[model samples]
Target: MIAPVVSAPTVSRGVRLGYGVGSFCTATVNAVPGLLLLYYMTNFLAVPAWLAGVVVTAPKAWDLIINPLVGRWSDRTRSRMGPRRPWLLAGACTLPIAFFLVFAGPPLTGVPAALYVGACFMATATAYALFEVPYKAMPGEMTHDYHERTSLLQWRMIFIGAATAISGVLAPAIVSSQGANGTVGSYRLMAATIAVILLVAMFGSFFGTARAPMTGAPEADRGGWREQFAAIKGNSAFIWITALACTQMLAVSMMLAAAPYFAAYTIGTPAATQTLFAALVGPMLLTMPLWVRLSKRFGKRGAMVLAALLFGGGTAAAVATPLFGPLYAHLTILVVGVGIAGVQLLLFSMLADVIAADAARTGKRRAGVLTGLWTAIESGVSSFGALIFGVILSLGGFIESEPSTPVQQPDSAVTAVLIGQTAVPAVIIFASVLMTLKYRLTPPVGPGPDESG
Candidate 1:
C-alpha cells in the first residue's frame, strides 16, 4: 500500500549549501581513486596489469568487513556533535593522511610492495568509510519532506558531479605533466587540498543541520553485528539495490581503469587519450542540471531506466569506433557520458528514498547502517571489477613499458579487452535495470517492514 507522504521540514539555505559542499568533498574523495588510481599504478608506478588490478581491488574487498562495523558503531554512537558527525570529523582528519600514503609510492619489490599497497589502501578505504557512511546518513535525519529530500539530493549531486568532473579531468593532466617521478607529489598535494575542502564541508554540514532528537530505544536499536548481517539478509529491496549498485559500479570501474589503455592504444596518443577521457566525463558535469530536471519529471526510476539504456547503447556503439574514427568514437563516448550522468545523479536519490522508506516503516533511523551496507557492497563490487579488468589487460598481453601498438596485440586479445571495457559493462548495467525493478520502496511512504534496515 502506498503510504501518506510525510511533509519534510523546511531546511535553510545555509543547510542546503552545507549539504552541497559536503557532497562535493565526499565525491572528490571517491572520484580520485576511481579515475586515476589504475592509471597511476599501471602507467606511472610500473605495476603489472594483473598486480595493478589486485592493488586496486583488494582494499575494497576489505570494506566487506569494515563498512558494516562502522555503520553499526555509528548507529549506537550518541554524542553532542551527533552520532554521525564525530566519525565524519575523524574520517575527514584521517583521509588525507591515508590518501597521501596510498599515493606516496611506497617501496615495492616482492611481498613488501604488495603488502604496502594493501595496507595503505586499507587505511584509505577505512577513512572513506568513516566519512562516507555517516555523511550519507545525515540527510534522512535532517528532513523528512519527500520533495525536500529530492531538492537536497539534487544539490548534493550537483556538487558531486562537479567535483567528479574536475578531479577526473584535472588529475590525469596533473599526473602527466608532473611526469612519473612527480606523480606521487601531485597526488600528495591533491590529497591535502581535497582533505581541507572536505573537512570544511563536513564540519559545515555537522554544524548547519538540525539534529532530530532521538527519543526511541536509542542504543538498543543499535543492532549487533549478527543482527546487522541478519537485517541485510532480510531486506530484499536493499539487497537488490545493492546488487544493482555493485554491478553498475563494477562496469564503471572497469571503464575508468581501462580508459588510459584505450586512449594510448586504441586512440593513438596519451595526450589525445587524456582529452578523450575528459570528453568522457566532461559532458557529465555540464549536463547534471539537465539530468536533475529529467529525474524530477520522469521520476528517479524512469530516469534510471533511461540512463541504463542510453549507457548500454552508447557502450555498444563504441565498439564500432575503430571504423568510425576518433571523432565518432568521442561522440559515442560523449553519449555514454550523458547516460552515465543520469545514472550517477539518480542512483543516490533512489537510495535516499529507500532509506527514508525504511525509516517510515520501522520508525527507526538507521541511515548509517543502510549507507554502510550499500557502500560496503559498492566497495567489493568495484574492487572485483578492477581485478577483472586487470586480469583482462594482463591476459590480453597489454604492457606498460611502452605505449600499446594495437596492431601488435593479437586481434582476439584486443577484442576481449574491448568487450570487457564496453560490452560486458553494458550488459551488467542492463542487468542492474532488472534489479531496480524489485526496489518497491518509494520516498513518500518510507520502507516496508520487509525492507532492510
Candidate 2:
C-alpha cells in the first residue's frame, strides 16, 4: 500500500541558506582532525603510529552506545524550543571547547599523552554527537516535499563543499605559518575559528526552521530498551542504509587518514600537498548544482550508482601513482576528488530520503533515531579506518623521524601509504556501490500526513 504524504512547513530562502552555512561549518570541524590529526601525532608530536591510531579511534567508539540513546531521547523530547534544537545548541556551545583541548598539546609523555588525547577525543565525540544527530535529523523533519528536500540538500552540499575546500586549503598553510613550534598553536587557532563558525551556523539553523508538529509518541517511546532494539532490528531499510553509510565512510576516512602522508612522502612538497587538496575539493563547489540536477533527473539511486562508479574508477587510478610521475599522481587524486564530490553530496541526501520514507511507512518520525544510528555507525567506521591505517604504517616499518626529503621514506612505507590512500578505499567503495542497488525507496508523489501505517 502507498503511504500517506506529510506536509512539511515551508522553509524560507533565508532559513535554507542558514542551514547550508551550518552544514559547512559542521563539515569543517569534522574534517580537520581526520585530515591532520595523524600527521600531528606521529610526525609532529613523536607519537608512535599505533598509539596515534588508538587515540584517533578509541574515543569515537563510544558513539556506538551513545548515538541510539541520543536519537531516542531527541525523538521523545517535548520542549518549547523543540526536540532537536536544544541538543544542537548544547553541542555548539561545547564542541569548540573540546576541539581546542584536543589540539592544545598538553606536555605529557607516553601513556599520559595517550590518556589525554583519548579523553579529549571522547569529549569532542560526545559534543559532536549532540550537534550532528539533531542536525542530520533536521532534513527529514524540515519538509516532506520531495522536490523541496532535494533543493534543501542542494544548498547543504554547496556550503559543505565550500567549507571543506576552504578549510582543506587553509589548514596546512595556517599550520605552516605558525612556525616550527606552531603545530599545536595552529590547531588551536583553527579550532577557535571553526568553533565560532559552528556556533553561528547552528544558532541560525536552530532559529530558522519551525519544528514539525509531532502528533504522537512512537511505540518504542513507552517500551523498554528491548522494544527499542526490536524497532531497530525490524527496520531493514534503515539497517541497509546505515551499513552502506558506514562502509562508505570507512572508504572516505581511510583516504582522509592517509592524505597527509601521501602528500608529504609521495608528492614531496608541502605546497603540492596544499594544491592537491584544493584540486580535489575545488571542483565540488562548482559542481554541486550539477549534482543536484543529476539526482533529480536520474533519481537518487541512479545518481548514486553513477557517482559510485566514477569514484571507484578515479580511486583505482590513484593506486597507479607509483607507475607515474608526481604530476600524474596529482591529476589522479584530483579525478578521485571529483568522484568523491558526487558521492559526498548525494549520500546524505539519500539518507534524508530514506528516513522520510521510513517515517511514512512506520507512521512515526524517527529522524533522530535513524540519524543517531547513522552517526554511531559512521563513528565506528571512521575509527576503524584510522586504526587500520595506523596498523599498516606500523607494520610497514615507518619511522617518526623527520625526513630531509619527501622521497627519503623507505619504498615499502611509501607503498603502504599509497595503498592506504587509494587501493584500500577503492575496495570498500566498490562494495558500497553494489549495495546501493538494493535501495528501492522512492519519493512519494502525493501530499498528506507522513504515514508508516
Q: What is the lDDT of residue 55 in candidate 1?
A: 82
**What is the C-alpha lDDT profile of model 2 across 1-453, one tens digit per residue?**
223365566777876886776675467766788888877777656678899899999887799888877887888887887788788788878877887787777766456776787898899889888888878887776776666677777788778777777667777777766763235667667666766666676677666655333333233345556865687687766677777778888887888788888877776655555677787887677777777788889987788888888777877888777678678877876777777777877778767777767666666657788788888887787678888898888888887642222225678888889888888889998998889887766666545433322
Among all candidates shown, the one with the greatest lDDT: 2
TM values, all candidates: 0.87, 0.91
The TM-score of predicted model 1 comes to 0.87
In order of listing, the candidates' clash counts read 4, 7
What are the per-residue Cα lDDT tens digits for candidate 1 across 1-453?
122265556766776766666675566666677666766666556667688788878788778878877877787788887787788788867876787677776544434655676788889899888888887777666665555666677677767766766566666666666653235567566665666666666666556554433323223245566876676577666776787778887888878776766665666655555566666677666777787777678777777888878887888787776687788878888888888877876777667666666666566567778888899988788777778877887777766432221135566556666766677778887887887666665444344323222
User: Which parts of model 2 are misplaced by more than 4 Å?
Assistant: 1-3, 6-9, 179-182, 210-220, 402-408, 445-453
Model 1, poorest ten-residue lDDT window? 211-220
Reference-based lDDT, residue 368, model 2: 84
Tell me the lDDT of candidate 1.
Answer: 0.69
